[model samples]
Target: MSLPNAVDYSIIICTYNPDRRLLERCLNAVSLLDTAGLVMEVILVDNNSSSALYTLDYVQFFLNAVPHSKLIVAREQGLSYARIAGIEASVGKYILFFDDDNEPDPEYVQVQKRLHAHYPHVAAWGPGNVNVDFIEGVDDKLAAYATEAFQDRHEVQIGYSNQRTWQGCYPFGTGLCIKREYFESYALLAAKGKFSLSDRKGNQLSSGGDVQMVLYCISTGAAAGVAPELKLTHIIPGKRTKIDYLKKLTYGTSVCYSTCLLEIFPDHLATIKSQMISERKFAFKVLKKYLMLFFDPRPKKALKLAAYIGAVAGDYIALNKPVPSGVLWVLKRLKAI
Candidate 1:
């Protein structure tokens, strides 16, 4: 595989007070032995983490092992803040975003080169993220990750199994990679204590910030594609793997998605809403799958599937609702929101 001769490729991760054990696995993956040739740096933005969970041993090891990585502490509240800080600090020509509770595949770094080589005009690429449902034993490095617990990948063109469509106007964050210039283009501006990306605060809670970025990218007519080769294992904690979490995730996804779609086109929302309502066939299909899982006899798998389908239902519900309540509430709540 021919890697890009470009100067920078920053792997930016935004993390909260993370599950230490899971984070350890991800840090290990990020600092793998074969990462030497990739022209990149790992920028872990600490989201106000007091101790900086990526420990000194982990930091020193990766700095020594991975070739390029720098740990900088950023005191910010949300994932968006951490990500933005990482972007501003990076010198990489391309930036790759990672969540804390993920273990990237060993072939991950190489995929960046492979994709860029194929489409020089393409601004972004999302990898195939295999979701790990649950891991047992607190400190066990060899925890189990169920491949069956995956989510929708929007790009199937590059062999990723995103459920949305072969070609997407937006992509997922787990495997999301973009040119550094693209990230820098949308810096948060402030005036008398206001910001340019200011409208995003309410949208972040509903989980559309990443999707919103992808939409912005695609709408601008920049080339975007999805590749399955760049991989990451998204770990699902015990709590997140429950029906209760599913309900919350579902509602949040719906609210967030609605907020994103409406933002991209203020006037076309009604048309989009109508079209979404017309796609009840797909929504029903999603619902039926969840109902069937209840009788499927596997507690773990059933619960996992339930959460996913519930999220879809929530999306449809938000679309069909006469008024978007949470959207308004969120706007009113966050001061800088």
Candidate 2:
């Protein structure tokens, strides 16, 4: 039951130094949202941007145009910190998180609210159809692997019971929605130092806070789901399509995978030790995988190899084991160690 006169939803957009055009597009889409009968508030979190975002003309316009909208600055420099700031300031029953580059369909909030009603057992959910719109065209090499950087979940239909079957079933943070109660619990855990994933500090692509949130929800006997009706466009800048950028993203994601595993499972170390392979064998595997990069040499293949090596390094750090010399050499060459 909702409290009397309480806001129904809090739309939180967390961003650092964002592109002006993209921010304008995002806010414009939000301003046009179909919010007829629902009580909603938009909270724009400036995550330590270099400039004063609240003073920007467009930002001021947005704040004045939308009822109950305001801009809050987060002194911290990470995405997770900005999100925490948003959570702390929100009073809505449900909280929605959107990136500055995300543009939702006009009916996104309504659709999300309807779906939540349909799946009351779910604690969190997001859009199933997340499409990418590139600001500029890419070369064939970069274009082939460009989509991998974004998400498209049109074919996925998941419920709480099977949320853990695959990572795809987990909701991406692009347009994630969570019950305020569950999010408050997560915030408490974070405050107590129990949850420590600070995702994407400034330009660094490190992630997994979204995954951690979903895992925590599931651990609390709740469910998560995705709905095709909840749609959004992830605007991608041309610079991010470069091979070097993709490689960095791959490495960051790989490390995040290992970090999240260790965070959620207390027995993770025991499990890894029990099934550990000899250092020599692991070194040989790394060498073999690296050699494949020389043969295929495609951007996609290179990224795949980077992800594998990153995962290995992440495991080494997480387990406090010495990285094999060969793996160490590879990581140094990739500038990821």
Candidate 3:
């Protein structure tokens, strides 16, 4: 796993049974990136894809096409584990964590390079636009997110961002850039059995790895930020537009939110209790706003409220039991945990 000594940026794309068309678009965009004199490397981690990726030439095409790029197989079935492998294998000063379906803006690298040079802590993520090209009958909720959630184009320091709002400064493992040291520290912590959360385990919606990493950075004097210039277009397929998937995603989001809260405030019962009380108050306020639906309900409005309830439940559950992490090294070798 030895790498060249002078690599500037390391891009890690973690994928599991991805759509070939979407992946191709992502790689196409990667091919066109203007490095601007900075040396870069791209590490593609295949998270136990059952598809005939290598035999079908999808993996081989990139090996020959993208410079300094190689495919690594992460037998583990979780996104967090795949990312850990990438962080361990990468050899660059800075690293970008990208999903397989993400298409970065051309100036993404250039802007990120500039920001990391100026900002010392070097932990951050950029917003992503929704690419609805392949989607049919695009869901209103999904479309609204692209324009509304990531609409802001300014740079916001992490702690100061709207933590209460869903569209906050938190990074979601897409187009997220951080110094290599931060990722190394995160991997070390996980290896030491300090923490664990499922940020998409197989077909499940559970997610918290990115959030936990950011929390770690904040705890250790690193401040993450929202760098608008490092934007990407997240390819939204029809599958993710389904109601069932959305519900699951909403639940996962809530669970992760609560899980992170528990991890951060592991100190005192009073502090955790107060935060939970505040959370319930916020949930009650949301329910109150949509209470009229009991008499005259709109499907969309009802669905939205249901998702909120799911999150509240997740918060409660997390208080009692949090995700555990161990045997990661053994899993890396055995491909099962």
Q: lDDT per residue, candidate 1, 130-198, as tens digits?
A: 545366522132222123223533233464222222244334677688877667764442223222222
Q: How close is candidate 3 to the true structure, as a TM-score?
A: 0.80
Cα shift from native, residue 231, model 2 (Å) = 0.4
Error of 2 at 98 (Å): 0.3
lDDT scores for all predictions?
A: 0.57, 0.81, 0.66
Deviation (Å) of 36 in candidate 3: 2.6
Residue pair clashes in candidate 2 = none
Report how far residue 72 has shifted in candidate 3, in Å. 1.0
Q: What is the clash tally of candidate 1? A: 3
| C-alpha positional error of residue 218 in candidate 2 after TM-score superposition, expressed in Å | 0.6
TM-score of 2: 0.92
How would you encode candidate 3's per-residue C-alpha lDDT over 163-190 as one tens digit per residue? 3223455565668887888889878878
Q: lDDT of candidate 1?
A: 0.57
Q: Sort all candidates by lDDT, best to worst.
A: 2, 3, 1
Greater lDDT among 2 and 3 belongs to 2
lDDT of 3 at 214: 72
lDDT of 2 by residue, 51-123 (tens): 9898799999998888888899999888988998999998999999989999999999898778887888888
The superposed Cα distance between candidate 3 and the true structure at residue 335, in angstroms, equals 30
Cα deviation of 113, candidate 3, in Å? 0.7
